[model samples]
Target: MSLEQDVATARQALEALDRACASVTKHVGETVDARRLRGDLSRVRDDLDLMAGQQSYSAYEPFAGVYGDGDDEGFGGAGRTGR
Candidate 1:
């Protein structure tokens, strides 16, 4: 399977897990275990989001001008990127 297909499958699984968690929380009254499960689910969602985003976005990619060729956007070029 392709990456996009894998990501879609994972997202669908996460959605199902989210609904299950909701049902469990409602039945269990949000106990410590329930909260921990929610936290773990949230972390998994975040990780999946990050991974999928990197496939189409550059948020996790390194700068093309790592050595500061006036393209660092003032990050390390001392504000000399000229906007």
Candidate 2:
């Protein structure tokens, strides 16, 4: 696959990661026990933020694969193949 496609996939992953972080933050605010997720959330947020930094148009190394295997049941919960 082309580097452009990899970069695009990484960008999409970064966006989804950001949305997940926001959701976690909202949940934390609504819960009384923020300490429970303090560590996990911090790590995940940092990882996502770091991953986003590698999506540059001129980035050399390819980003980690974002697409799942062809047998991924996550596509539509019906074991859909590649999209």
Best lDDT among the predictions, by candidate number: 1
Q: Candidate 2 local accuracy as lDDT?
A: 0.57
**Weakest ten-residue segment in model 2 by summed lDDT:** 55-64
Off by over 4 Å in 2: 30-83
lDDT of each: 0.76, 0.57
Give lDDT tens digits, candidate 2, residues 4-80: 56657766876686677667778558454554555555555455445556433333335335444434446566646
Per-residue lDDT of candidate 1, residues 1-83 (tens digit): 98779989998999998998898799889589998998888778777778776542323446555754645444555545544
Question: Alpha carbon lDDT of residue 25, candidate 1?
Answer: 91
Model 1, runs deviating above 4 Å: 55-83
In model 2, pairs of residues that clash are: none
Residue 33's lDDT in candidate 1: 93
